[model samples]
Target chain A: MTSTETHHAAGAASSTDAPAIATWLTTADHKQVGRLFIGTGLVGLLGGLVLAVLVAFERIDAEGFQLLDSGSATQVLSAARLLLTFGAVAPLVMGLAVAIVPLQLGSRSIAFPRVAASGFWMWLTGLVLSVAAIIGNGGPSGGESEMVDLYLAASVVMVLGLALAALSIAVTGLTSRAPGMGLLRAPFFSWSSFVGSIALLMSLPVFIGTSVYLYVDHRYARAAFGGNFGVNNWVGWAISQPFTYVLAIPVLGFVLDAIPVLGRTRLAQRPAANVAVGLVSVAILASLTHRAVTLPWEGDGFFSGLGTKIADLLPFGLVNVIPLLGLLGVLGLTMLTLKSAKPMLAAPLPFAVLGLLMILLGAASHLLYTVEDAALGGTIFEAGSYVAVTFGTVLLAFGGLTYWGPKLWGRRIPDKAALPLALLGFVAAALGSLPYMIAGFADQPAGVVDGFAYSGPQELWNVVTTGAFALMLLVSLAFIGLAVRSFTAGEAAGDDPWDGTTLEWATSSPPPADNFSDLIVVGSEYPLADIKNSGKVG
Target chain B: MLTLPPAPQPAPKRQVFVGTALVSAAATMLVGGMLAIWSQFRADAPFRESPRRGPIKDWMPKDIVVPEVAANMMLIAFFVVCVMAQWAVWSAKRNDRQHAGMALGMTLLMGLATLNAQLFIWSQMGVDVRGGAFNSMFYAITGVMTFLVIAGLVYTAVATFRYLGRGNSDVPTLSAHALYWYFLTAAFSAVWFVVYVQK
Candidate 1:
């Protein structure tokens, strides 16, 4: 077949060829698959954010049940965490990678495109079933036994779906790069997606393994792992501190990718930035070891001797600090890049920068939470850190969507409209997290809605956190509205609106069926820049 | 007359091999996590005095005796299975359809044999699923391993049929099939030492 025929065959189906829903249902196009993931992920984000808001509101009084009963408090908290981490963040990040990575690599299509499409549907199905199970009281510490079984089974399906998507992204990065675009030389977003995908692939299976154990032990015999109450004990690590940072691995990629382009500068210290992203994945290693090894920081003999204390603290510190250092490295590199370049005051720039700061702040808080003397292990401070990372990822997802919106859709999100949402997101993230940290420091317990004795002004902090969550809900809704309005009806974005240096910008807005009109063979990391400089195409 | 420069060649797509390697890595970690949990339980299980064997610190209950011969045979079978899987890959690369088919068939047969051995061990031991932590975990670990082996067998069958029907060697699929069996062998090795040999 001729090249044009191949491109046409690989391209997306036209509206005239099939019914719209049918075309979408069977689409192998990376862009369509990505849109499916992103659209579903946003719905999940909205659902999770609503749950978070309810949980926060329930905590406001700190003396009695308000929105939630004692019987349901823990389950709600577990469900919220599950939905936020797995349902929202994982899909959003994976969707961005699915759509954008192939374009960045100058590939005609993503590797195993059908597999990616299958992953989206499977993820959607599992997430929906998980929500149904949660509604039926099937989450961690749930009352209904059968519902618990359904939840466990659904979670496995969900995690495996994400894993399948991760596999496709990792392979695309490995085998789909344009000639001369080596791994290191690939765009930071694609590179980070690669690293992050590998990390998820390795780490998520551990969750799957644990879930299987939990399922069997819970379903047939409650002897090994505790039946319903023990669900979080085995799988909670996937949604918490070090593991949460794993979700943010691709967030760093977005910051790195967007900042350099918006600043109108080639990324300085590109290798260091790459190393920074790789370092964040170290959390995956720490997370895998989490179940097997418990840090001795809480033991009586933890402070008995200097050697013993060092032994106890070293692993804990490394696990918490390394990812923090990684985020710091990204922050430093962004600063260095922005120092000499006159950056465009674009919406994506602040979203990327502030989002990185939120994640950095969260990582820093997690390190502090590890201080044995702080006695913050079971406190709401852990929630504080979780919020920082989770919402930080949300902001980064926002940054990525705005930066790549024109490419994903055929129109750009209005800069003036999107700019304020960045600030709103920062405020929402800060308020949503810092209050929880303060409340945690004040001796308020984690995952408790009420009836805890505490001397510190926990009520005030809880009230503040409720407001923060409310603000976050508003921010999320507004951003979603803006995205929908802009994508469907906004001004048309010409190709190369950002004058992007990467290969993705060399194609038309929203790209064609084959991604590129001609296969782009690159000689440098900045292929478009090379083409423009020489006034020629490869 | 002006002529356009030759269009660049597309990069080779190795999605099958790469995707399989990723899936294999995930499977390895899944089994590794299970083994770690098993080790933890064993380390933490209390020492108990039994009538026949006094003051034993074994994680498995005193009543359960894992059939040593069958378990060992299963391990041996996996080793052979890995070898056969690799032979199929080597044969496929050379377009030797008969040898590849035979190798895949032997791999599948041995894989089924290991499954049979596992089932035999389960029957001989007669451990209840709901008996205790040890019994539950034993079934969990072994059951997951059994599932992976079943997956590997299906993979081998697909590779064999695809190779034969196409009249050409699908080396990537064959290599991926081999890699998965290798992973299964390594995973079962850990299981054997932890759940059988060490116990």
Candidate 2:
């Protein structure tokens, strides 16, 4: 009848049974939140992907190029924009990265779980309210003002939550070790997640704070940083700085996974990862200056002047491009070596390859625009480049789920049917974004608020985009159906599915409460590989 | 092949009692103190017939009205909600049906009291520029938080009703949930200081 014993008694249910609602309330277990994060993040991904398809179709046929085109067809496009901007802060990034990164790094609980949970709840609140605000207030306030508040709040909650999650991860990494875990012995995915979590901790908060400032102006009828007050310029800096690689970290994880399997040994240069990780982290922080800002510098004379001079210098921009180039190097290595693997014609492999490909496309496309913007800026071209970010994230999210859902859940997805269905989703999304690139480059009208639709080649571009949409929708339907089936009644899976090369695979298919009965610290990068090739993994 | 180690034996009852007390004290100190300041400032805004001279007005600018009071009260209620929630978690973990039921009831009652106090204050207020946004924000934030608190209470009540009879309270998931309740309570208190008291 002791309190400690009280909470612990209700957990003896079957893994297949639904968790008790109270259990969800009284629990502070990281694993529960982590699983919920994964589930909810995937749900968000599903909703977002479907939204993307609607957007894609609209891009192709803005002027009614749908199978069921009517004036109402525009609702699909409008809905997509609403979803996209529903929260200006990235949901997939905040949701998945914060949720998954912590669990992947072996932690008891987030350092600030209350803050973390509050962050998430408030974010939900923000998005829901913003969407409601948009619905209630039309035209002038619609998407721009009323809807923007919810996202602004979401950004704050996410920033707060993520900072807490990252702190938790770092605390766990720093202090929560069982008997023998060391920095060097940490799991590679966790190591990468550690690095990614740091990037999140530092960068996301600034973005949230920046967005809040912009929001306050809109809310109170002050132009503190929007309108002529410098919202546009400031946003250019803020979004580009944190997000470009708020994105890169996950891709970095996938890249880590891809590299070893192709080489089948330790990374050719393992120390370089630490160095590269640090460099990218700095680069993201430094890029903030590039955001058009309006600051009245205090403290008169030489010292202050030198600071301002340094801010304006190209070295700052150069600092950013350096890590980006290093990341490109990582991706390049993957592309060359991936050909070495037997291309396991399975669910994740194609998606992984395509994901890596879109990342490369996005990197190159964006790099081109940054270096010179006549061909891109605000055009469908820029949209296509941005698509690379979402495309890569979505691909990996779904692909990773498919490749390892069985291992994680102890349940097998319908591989033969589900694999192709998932791949089609990826292909459809990729092809869907392509027309945006063409439209931008061709100088067809772009920018959401701009009503200046191009007169020439518009119809043709619209047609191509609509065609892409048709394919994407079919793919989305297929994926959702498969996800639902897998969760509900997919075949029971076993340990070692996909011959997964990580500590995660070494445990039971769904894993036990403590993760491992006895913690097995790795001495090297390819510990799982050593186990697979020999006998003792982890 | 990978059997987990036996679950750690539940901590001693004394330890649980001490932890609950400590958490409650922290909530009161951290959360209750905030309510007093927020209420003082919220009342002060309307009390000012003309811009008076004070440290806040001098540096804060005359037109700037602070909702320090609204945030203070809301944050206090939030932590009160948290203490009840933790009490519920302690009950649920021990398989004590009566305790769990009592804890949930306490949690809901605290929420209702908070709403009553908030609406009572709102009803007494007159329309003005500086206090309007502050009051609106206060209500919005508290209203949302109240909904969450109620949701948590109901969810735990359901478990108390169903599984308490079954006599199993060892929920692996319960710890995370309790942590979040405490987390939300803590966050609201922290934000009260930042967004309200300081202003």
Candidate 3:
């Protein structure tokens, strides 16, 4: 066995001591389950990326495809593209969020990892069934009854998984903690992750429940969105804005986490982060309430009518902008702080910096929910922006994982040179997205398959995006290799590697199965730093 | 050899009572559903309109827009029964099994009644979006009510399964699942009789 395993063995009897498959199934050992959660989420992310690339190709050349010279219309292709927007991509992103946030909080694992695992399995099953139905020529209009039913089932599974993950995270946050990790003292990223987890747990179900009804009626009951004659579009609108929050919140966490470390100061204000989270949650609920009465809800609708007027009692959406402004101000503060702060080229810093920059672009633009061109949104710009934001968060998560992974494994990855690929991955994606922004400005239809047949800046943007994508892929592959190697074969990390703050780094590199056996008292935010300065070791 | 007294059989007969009440409520729901369907559809005048001034007609004049009276009445009654049944379940928590069972029986009877009412309403519309937003409101509200009734049935069934296996049920799971059904029923019923009825 490895030294880390020997250290783990020295601690106490282990869950791994159980028979093989049952050990995985029944173990409450948080680290094992956490690996499963992260691995599963990454795989899901990869699948989502594949779908994204295909959709972007289809949209870029909307005029048709001449590669086959088979007479394909943009209208037909766009319908398929629309399906990807709601049906495929959104759910994929959500699945990833469910897995990532819970781990960030220093919880052993989510409350019900089995349920969490089941949720993933059920979700995949639903996706396969729904995608198959669609691939076999199905939309709300074209699909048979069986196909629609299957799609509804798939949505249920995705929601179930999200709910399961959310609950697990919340429970862990509330009941499990690394001793001395008070709610107020939680790592900003973990705090944001905690708040976002709660928001998602509640909000996702309502959307999932409504979406199922929409699918049911569209296929089996009424043409809700299609038949414009007298349909109540409230559900349609509810689906849109709440979804934006689901997409935004975790990245919000990423941005929050990056600021303090990168800036070399405490957050501009702790309460500001708390308020941002609360405002966002309230905003989501109030906005949906706007839809609770009407057919289609809008960002503005939640504030306008009698029911909306009552909801306007809070003007939460407006209040929401306040925290964001405060956050932006803090981000600005961080920029100022980073100047004075020591710039270290460690695993977490460069990616943390790039990721934070990307988040600034993403979170800022999303705050303005005004309708944009579907053609524009469908363009490579939107995809590029999504990649920028996603990679930024993913990069931060990688840094956090690596920074703490050794702590969790009791082995800091030695050979720091193995880190460039991870940083490169973030840089490549950030730069890659640049071309898409330009292509979108030129009105190049994105997600299109063929290019030469069309002529313009959109085409030029598409070419650039494709070239950038190759770089991104290379970087990503390198990142995976580096990560896998470090996780398994890197240098032995001690319990306190970074002279860190927080309780997780205070105890054994990986704490016991029950987490820290005794609650450590917190005298400062960075507890381990003081310990390290004192040169305290057993 | 067996000299049990009929007057006072035993002390602490609570579990038996609660179990009986649940089983009976399930039975009531199933039976009432059958009776409502038989009475409304088995008779020849399933679609006949009532010209006479009924208490409900006076209470909600707008409800008069729908021509059929029997289905509407059954629907409203079922909505009431669902509320009563949930009340009974709530009371059972206090060891009031008989009251709980009675409440559940009421809910089941009402749930069945609502189901028949739905069938009648569906027959009237043939699923068409007519009678203005009122028609849509009427159908949507009742449709939600129907789903709740079915959900209630599932929650109780899951509870029964847990009870059989563990001796004590997963109360949180039951509460989480049951609370939604109860609220949905209460809300749908209230909307039907309170909001849409007068509108």
Candidate 4:
């Protein structure tokens, strides 16, 4: 191929030359692929939020079925959980990593760009089929066996797609660094993405293996695993506490990356930040041990032996404590960074900080949920934790979009408009989750629309939770509107709007097809800072 | 006098070997998780009274005895497969295209032999999948092994074709193919120990 043909093959040509839809379909550009993932992920978030609102509304009456029936209530809950974690949060985080990690690493393109593109399409197809199967009564507790099989099979495909994308991202981080830039010296976002992608790649397969078993047993015989009713029991670990935190792993990366830049200072304790991210990924180990190892805490032989008690408590303590320590470490590091820095009251800053706070709250709640005396398992408290992680991830993703929207679209999302949405999101996440948690203590059962009595004022809590979901739904819609409006027609963002120190800031607002027009060789962690200090560019 | 700046150096391209290693690690974990589940189920299953035998504690159905010879043969084939895969990688590194091609072909043959052996074992067992938990999990575990073998075969073939088509040895592709086979060998070893021998 000619050089120009080669360039076009590499997705260097502008979309205007060819049909836009065709260009997108065939494009191998990480930016375009990232945009596709982000767009679809937002749509997924909106759908999941709608379902969540429906679920919360159903719970409002507490004694009667409102919008969902007893038969389909659990399935809808499963669907909402499925869509929020796999469909929405994972894709959103993976999208940001795919689009920005290469740029941060100063590489011309993402590794296996075509593979990443294929991953997006495959994930989308699986997501669509999964939703369709759920609608057809094929999810965990669906009545139809075939649809349940479809959901299982489709979920495997979805997970594989995400895994493929993660492989590309992880490989890119490992192999695509610019000259003189080591892994430790790479930006916080890139480092955390590398770690998070590996975590996803490792943990997601267990889900796939479990799903395979579920599929075969459900398809062939209902003997091995509980056929339909057993679906959640087998795979629910992926969307619950600790595992749900897997989706939030990259949230810390975004928070760390955005805080220092918005504060207009270098991050304090950079290594600690990296360690915190790695510590969070350690939860993947906890997730893997979920069904494989049983914690015999509920047995009647209460205090069998000291060794037995220690062994039982060890896994629980390690599982709950490690990720919590990671979040606490992040909180401490963020505060330390802000203490000495001249901070800007930017939209992304509040979003990042508040998002981190919400995730910390979620982790703390998970630690509490593990207490045997709490009796929080199999309660809406689990839903509360899921909401905090899922919505916290949403908030972080929005912050990422706003922070990097300039680089992505050559326009800034109006900060004044976005700032309030961040606060609203925090409120929604807090209200949506905390009330459910309180009701969990009140003995509200999980995965039920009706037919349960609790002494606690479950109705009032559900009413508040419903209102919270409504607020969250509004926040999601408004954020989408802000993104669309800003990306299409907003104030022009210069090459380095935030006066950033990273390689991404060194390039044009919307980078060229090859990302950089010239080779960028880094000499320090802050390459742009080095250049500025040397007076190479003003 | 006007001076021209030096040309820019090209960026480092993607490394297939690194990608392959990551993929191999994930595949290992996938098989490891399945095997763990299999062990969990076996430990949990209660002893059943067989018509021919008094009380069998085995997870496998009493009527069907796992074809030990076939399973052992498959395990042996994988060991040979790994050696041949490494030989191919060695030849490719030395630019010995003829030897590399032969080594890869041998690896493919051995892989197919393993697959054939596994099929033989399945046919000999003839256990109904709907029989019970043991039967269901048996298929789940062995079915995944079959899929991995097929994937490894396709990978080897692509490497061989690429080496022959270009009339040159591509060390990275060959090395990655070797790593994948090694992973397969390890996975099958676990399968043999846990499912075939232990049962």
Candidate 5:
């Protein structure tokens, strides 16, 4: 038995003590379930990357390589989006939340363990059915009507699974904290997860409603969305300027949680950080404005009337700039925290810094996009800026896995391989997105298969984007390889490897079935730090 | 040997109540979104004539026919079910098992009636679901609510059976179930006003 098992042998009566395939499949242990979520999400990432590469290859040539017909291209785009947004990034954050929140809260297990496990399975089923429908040339955009039904059904099921998981996580946060770990004192990630879960709970059902309408429209009543709604509109907000930032809110939480720990100091303005996270949740309302960015309805129609009404009722500038406010709030808090202490050059720092920088770039671009100006509305720049921001979450998720690897798996992902790959990831992301933003400004239209015959700069930009996409694929594969190797063969990481400030570091690496050997009632944000320095915990 | 602290068990009752509340909160957002679409389709303009009031032939392809009176009847039935559900909760809280059981049974009956009313409305509609956005939305909103009503009915049935059979039930679960019934009542009323009365 391992040292952790030997130490906790008295309390090791559960099935988690037996590390077998059956244990993994059937275990309701939050840690095991979390690992399953992360692993499944990785599979999704690989699939999304392959699809992205195909799309990029098509974009490489102006005549748009006839590798897939336009309908098939639409299918690929939809599938890639579902895989990345739901399959990869959302699950990754959820996995981290599931694994880390309870431990940070000093709770032994997640609330509603069976519900969470069921959610994971449901999510997998939904993802498989949706992807299968796409592969079979039966998606919402596909020619076959039945495929469209499959797409709608599968997507709704997938969202329901996520909603279930979010409910479990949110409930655990509300009622399962350790004796004295109040809301303010709860670790940043756990608190952030709670907020993000609430946001997901609130937003996903609206999408489900939309999907239900689509299903009804496609199946029985052919009247709604005016034949315009499909997979494209389902993710339109997700790929667009403002609402896409809603997806990045949790990454900001990761940064908030990591900054104080990486700096080996207390956060500068903890309440303000919490408020900023709250502001990000509030920013979800502004997402409705994304429709205005693309639609040219200044004079007539319901959209114009509603837009004018909304502008009059609310602070137009403030509502439009909610994401900017949230991101800047994070940046300001980060700078304040770094100012108070000497930050060590560590594994998470590069990922944290680069991720935030890319996110900022995306937010800045959004600020410009939300402007009344229509010049850059339909350009390749729209896609470019989106790629930068959405991928920022990808970078942050990688860093989170690294930052919490020891606590999660009893080993650290070797910095020798990880750090360099982290840098390469940032480089590829910048190269991939910056050119598109520039090309977009040059009047290069988006959603085009072939290069426009009239535009010179669009071709040059597409070539650069294609090359950058290839490089991104290479870096991603290498990073995944390094992570797998670390899981199997990396050196052991003892408890508190980086001298973390949170409660999670107080336990053994790959903490035993029981999270802590002893209960430590936390009175401050940095509970472990206090215990190590003063020899007493609150 | 390092003796770890035993893990604390979560309060399952509290978890159930919280989970129900959260789901109800999410349901509110869905209603809001559906209303947003309804408003957009109505267009609210001087040039756009009332499609419902126009010649029946003009409503052939895209416009859907809504059964206004039947929808209003469903709303009233749902509201009555909600009242019975609240009575069940109140009786349960007071440890009045006999009253709670009767109230819950009534809730189940009313919920079934509401579902029946919905189906009757669908059967009575002049156009099928393929009629267009208005028809599609009419089905979508009512269809989703019908499912919720079925769910509430199952919960009420279980709560009623548990209370009647064992002289007790999980009060928290029952209460939470009632809360969802209340939500369904409010939601149906709002949808009724927008889709039927206002139009």
Candidate 6:
């Protein structure tokens, strides 16, 4: 028998029994759930991009009522934050974990498949409700208290669903591995998901409790989270700084694992890399330090006097700086791993490199926010920084999709399409964020529309940011077009696409219903590599 | 014909047992995190200046009575129910079916009794939910716990019924259910210690 036939003959089993639509909707299969998450997240991402474009359009004119009213602008800003963070990134990562963790660990299915399905539905429900509520003018700054309450309730439910999904992934990672697959031997993506899941599990619940109380106060008492506190605090904990880093943690895994496979080498300092991922959990707690920071800068002179402002970062530096340190650790180790490896010519490389750069850009911006003289908080710079990190996740998610797409859809996303898209994504991310950072240094504020006194440089910056956002929207469209096309009609990908080191590569592209026909005993992190060298299917 | 090993099954027996225990521990962490945030908010809440801070009003009747005897009774009964649940699991594992059934049945009865007592406590509360931040927290935490308890009781009841009907039970499944029950017990104990007894 051919190697492909031998591999398929060994472990393939038919676990799916229902009709197509029914199967997808009711699937306990990790792959389908992952697809569901990715599809849903893509839609959510598109929605967020559309909202961002609208906001960008308004910002282009730098003066009165360019594209939206004050209330509309505020609503769009808040909605984009909600959709991108809760509706897009979390789902994207969770979906990948649900689909990939079991396969990576050499398990047939996730530990709690039904629970994972339940979590998806719950998340979908929450996302739909929240998006609707926000669109209907029903959040913190929305005039009506009832709408705000709906917003609060919807957000809580959405976050809860994400928490449930993370819980399932974590438990699966912890419990469902093959007989000999120790924690250290699990794929980087699985390990990162495990750590990120714990972080989400611990953090989201606090947000839920706070939201519950917000509900209570709004509904009856009117005693807590007054003024913009309700909205700002939520943004602070859920979308900003350390929280975003923790959310971005899985992408680090995606890059780590993808790089090793693409580079044809084992991870350098694997244990240290795992610890770097682990450090993010502690870094999540450090997110609280941001609440104490406020920016009071008035002009470009802030940069000229950087040393004095940086010194102001000392008091909050211990906690506020941890996430940056973690990112640096990841970057340092990734470089070390790549140094010894024979890197392949592949699409994931550009995506990974750009992803790390964007993460660093965001981290640098976060550091600036902590510096008292930098006075960058509540400005376009901070928002730009957040976009950078968020965009980093998008790139990583795209990289993961590109890396795993063949295995998932039985087709490679034509490199002709993917390579250009990755490059465009990087340029767009840079254009989208860097100019805004300059504008923030120019003393341009964030989260406001139709109010700032128009200045020459500020207007120029706004125009640049607007143009970049327009390009980003186009890139997003092109990506969606390529992804959909490839998913349906692209060239067929074989079992091992990237000479991947992990277990998932051992099975066929779009693995069979039961994942594998026979169990593959995992002896090391690079199990598939071992099999390849041994010239055996099993 | 080569038969591939059966498609990866759900977590193995021991893993299921340990996994559920881990979930319970995580659940505790969640509850603990919530409490920590709530306490911080409680401390910072602008209580004195609020119009809602005054005596109980006529329009909004009090739903929760503070420090009621029924509240204490409910806590004690919950403890008893938790103990009975463990007894049922232990008896079943020891192959003592009769005692297991009896203990499980008693556990369910007491669980319902505890729920009813909590409802009683809710009715007797001298403060409205809107009375203050403390009042809001007290109700929110307890109210959520009550709903959780009902859900856990239903789950345990189903597991118990299956055991009685089949004349056999999967120890892991039973243990998982029991583990969740214990989580509920521990969570409620925390609420009792902080919200009811200490406050």
Off by over 4 Å in 1: A1-7, A11-16, A291-304, B1-13, B50-54
Better of 2 and 3 by lDDT: 2
The reply for model 6, stretches above 4 Å from the true place, is A1-19, A227-229, A288-318, A454-456, B1-11, B45-65, B165-169
Query: Model 4 Cα displacement at A182 (Å)?
Result: 0.9
Off by over 4 Å in 4: A1-16, A292-309, B1-14, B48-58, B167-169
* Native contacts matched by each model: 0.82, 0.00, 0.00, 0.65, 0.82, 0.44
**DockQ per model, Cα:** 0.72, 0.05, 0.07, 0.62, 0.64, 0.41
Task: Put down candidate 5 lDDT per residue, B111-198, tens digits, no spaces.
Answer: 8888887777777765566656667777787778777678778778877776665443477777888898988888788877876665
**Model 1 CAPRI quality:** medium
Model 4 preserves the real interface contacts to a fraction of 0.65
Instruction: State the lDDT of candidate 4 residue by residue for A263-379, as single tens digits.
Output: 988899999999998889878877887552335466546556768788877876677688789889988999999988898878999899998888888888877777665678778
lDDT of 1: 0.85
- Candidates ranked by lDDT, best first? 4, 1, 6, 5, 2, 3
Q: What lDDT score belongs to each candidate, Candidate 1 first?
A: 0.85, 0.51, 0.49, 0.86, 0.75, 0.76
Q: What lDDT tens digits, residue by residue, belong to model 6 across residues A375-474?
A: 6666788878888988888888888888888888889888777888889898888888888888787767888866776354777777777777777778
- Writing each residue's lDDT as its tens digit, candidate 2 over B1-199 gives 5555765545222322323332333333323333433344345554333435333322223444555466467668767877876787787778776786687677667766666655554444432312343443344334444444555556456544544433443343334345545755665556455444654
Candidates 2 and 6 compared: the better one by lDDT is 6
TM-score winner between candidates 3 and 4 = 4
Q: Estimate candidate 5's RMSD in Å.
A: 5.2
Local error of candidate 5 at residue A368 (angstroms):
1.3
**Runs of candidate 5 exceeding 4 Å displacement:** A1-21, A226-230, A288-290, A293-316, A453-455, A517-519, A533-538, B1-10, B44-70, B157-169
Residue A470 lDDT, candidate 1, scale 0-100? 82
Model 3: per-residue Cα lDDT at residue B103 = 56
* Interface CA root-mean-square deviation for model 2: 9.1
lDDT of 3 by residue, A243-315 (tens): 3444445545545555455444555556666565555454354334424211223345544566855564345
Candidate 4 CAPRI category: medium
